[model samples]
Target: MECAAVSAPVSSHPPPSQINTSPEGKKPPEHLRRIIGEPPGPIVALLTRGVWALLTALSPAARDALARFVGNLAYTLGIRRKVALDNLAQAMPEKSEAERRAIARGAYITMARVVVESLPAGDRMTPDWDKQGIEGEEAWAALKAHVATGKGVLLATAHFGNWELVGQMLIRFGVPLNALVRPLKGALNTRIAENRLGAGAGLIYPKGAIQEITDAVNRGESAFMLLDQALPAKAAVFVPFFGRLASTTPAMAVAAERTGAPVFVVMGVRPPGPGARFRLEVEGPIPAPKPGEFADPITEHTARVTAALERAIRRHPEQWLWLHRRWKVQPPAALVTAPSPGLTSGPAPESAPKV
Candidate 1:
């Protein structure tokens, strides 16, 4: 199968001592490494493929039932459950403990739906995408107009809802989307990449293709990136996310500041249904950074993006990909303080909601 051309693995080949390493820093024990650090064995890879195919074949009702079962199962298995629960608690302190737990487990269910049903390569974009796929009419009209301007679009979407499908649905609808993706290390993730590429979406490797991607956007080519994942300490700045400081990449903000391109936030949420349906949403644009907002343009812009994301997550509490360790990198105690004296902290000014 054809795969999107990604940059070479970010790091040079590791020494033998660090052969099987988790991206999370430390190495897991020998057996655990096989699950997290090392690539899956052939048998496991084969099983994964079989499952993917089987899931596609199942009826929508069956798939829905399985989605719930798998989501709860993952939580019960504690596959990053603690981190998810912690994030939910910290982000939504006002909610009851039981509500947080339900949201946490429901996130897994969303994951299961994503894994089983995302569109594959060569899936044609049809009128159905522009019709049933959209959730907000004005948001959709704004997005179409933004694309028409040939002024690059940089969409900062989280690992929320059916994010992979967001790209697929857009691609299928004849939108040119080149996503900044970090290809996974193992067999399962690699195959997943292959399917995404097949769906007619372009891939921009995150490690070294910033300039190329920026140029593409400037030329009217749209790009998407996940804004709710961890980044290296040296690269990301801590921004308030879900009430705590999360190390955020200033890429979207930086790009918007540099090119004067419009930044849009989007999501493909799975509405409650027993059919294959997704509400592809185009949220309002994040205003370009300005000098008066704060001492640093990057922080001001990124914090606005983070707040926008928080608002989206709040709208549908269970649709987010909660298992991700979004707040893994905390800010230094020195940097964790209230906003500077005169600068009020909040979301960037949204333009009048015009189509």
Candidate 2:
């Protein structure tokens, strides 16, 4: 799975420009600019770079241990602790309190490790797939088949284990991949964009990205979209997740239905061990909707893809991002009684308590 044969991508798209310069169209004081560099204060800049250097310098095992330590500390400090526990309680009532607590702690650890692992720059961003033991032959085949049609491919993913690595793996497999990402703030945004582009993946910002995504796909390029995030009711279709209706964006489904592109749910799984390389799990080219496939193919497609993600998360509950308010938006009472287009029929759960 070494990508030695894969050449660096020569993208026609322009690289993301730096946007961290002074706000008033004025330059920062020379000394301050030299030290802090951008909107994030000097202390933050130094701290971020310091942590990155420390994590990068450590061996993989040590890095994992340190990440675990940070995660445990966060859990102990009650950082989003209630949100995680509440999510677990709602999503996995079958599990005992002790089990759920362990899962929450592990979830924190996974999040920490994701951040730490993502901080490395350049070639280190591309993992050794053989070392990771990523099993994706079927997925690769499906991707190739979809791309061969020249209709493009919709790669549906989530905030599950090492999601960043999944995109890198796709690029390594020589898939011309573009991802829809929410931009970070200040210098961090520029740095992350640079890293993604450096890894040979194109970045698609969420604002006004629909047309761009469609155009990119029209050109036979694959687009990666994270389908698990919570969205406003107007922008989302209700779908069953863990026995509750979660407000989910139907972008992937809409794109697939509109463009005749195949949708594949891909994620990375972290096997239990010290410094274990993540395993790639790809499920789909999920069956496309037939004409008049019941009603509202877009909603049905969204549910099917959401179900795929739910199955993956169930396999490793701790690896999924439990801290996010996944079930935050509930359908209005009228819609709950008489479900509208793009909505599944269900009694809305009480809205998630504000964090």
Candidate 3:
């Protein structure tokens, strides 16, 4: 029998199907199981606080530079550089060879700076998002209008730019938002969580988060989702990204489908400045399913979001995270992969001009 288009998301609650099974039955992958729980507890909270304190001690310049250092170091060590470069090549195949390479280098620098800037700090800065010069102001304006209706809004995002900072920005504006995030293992995760929470954003794990988000929306709360990861085991469908099939999460679609809540594809892009300035762009009351469409709107919703993400990355290649294995699972040979002229494979060829 076929499962629901968007199968009940892999929540933390044990399924009845598991009750009759023996140990021999398939176990969830370690990564899925690891994040299948709630946010860190008090001990975890304490650790997070300490980490944030350490990060907070650093000056803004130091923090930004440190992130740049890590990004370069990661490239040197070949961490996700292939995937980053590959993804970049796909996005801007028309650029000159040098231009493509420059974008890659800028991307690395941006990735590293973004990471460092996300570190836990004693206090989080509240930047006026309007100053960032978002291109699509009408979309965001419409979303804000929904706030008056008292219906909670869902801002679906991806691993594109400084996403966590998006949550921080909303919180600073006093917009109550709960960000759905996977827990990082050990001390590092704890610290980041603490800093984020301190910055006025709430965190929920995928396991039990559905219920929480649903209830919040029912009671008029806004939520944020980052839907740009490849979860091979869980129920995910392929969607075109950079002309390649990338595993897109159906959670945003499911959430919208179930709640009848209007969905907006919002993302944060880094601005050109001395320190970290960001532009938050919100797009659409993402068209939802009508009376009788059989296929999931998630695939469509994901497609739209992916297109937006690609555009954003193209505009600011340096600000996106190139280290994440976004296209880890390659599709059939028919799909595109080879590097086109001007768009060489892998990290920037060392002397390319930034886009």
Clashes of each: 3, 0, 6
Judging by lDDT, tell me the better candidate of 1 and 3: 1
Model 3 agreement with the true structure over 1-355: per-residue lDDT tens digits: 0000101211122233422121123221222223222456778868766756777788776777777777667677777667767766776688776776666666677766655666745433333333565546566666667755767788877655667666656544334566677656555555456555555455666676667678767755677887667767356756666666777677777777778787777777766654666667666766654655534456665665556556556566666665567778765454345322221112321122223
Candidates 1 and 2, the one with greater lDDT: 2
The residue pairs that clash in candidate 1, if any, are 121-198, 121-199, 125-172
Alpha-carbon local distance difference test for all models: 0.63, 0.67, 0.59
Specify the poorest-scoring 10-residue window by lDDT in model 2.
Answer: 1-10
For model 2, the stretches where C-alpha displacement exceeds 4 angstroms are: 1-43, 125-128, 131-139, 148-151, 186-190, 338-355
Worst 10 residues of 1 by lDDT: 1-10
Task: Give the least accurate 10-residue stretch of model 3, judged by summed lDDT.
Answer: 1-10
TM-score of 2: 0.80
Please provide, for model 1 over 1-355, each residue's C-alpha lDDT reduced to its tens digit, 9 standing for 90 to 100: 0111111121233233322111212221222112112456888888777766776567667877877788778889999998888888887889999999999888888887766555222332222333454545555566667766765577778877777767655554435666676545666566566555555456666555577567767665677788887788789977777667788888778777766667777776666665455666566576655667567877777777777777777888898887877777766777776542322236434431222
TM-score of each: 0.79, 0.80, 0.74
Off by over 4 Å in 1: 1-47, 119-136, 291-293, 338-355
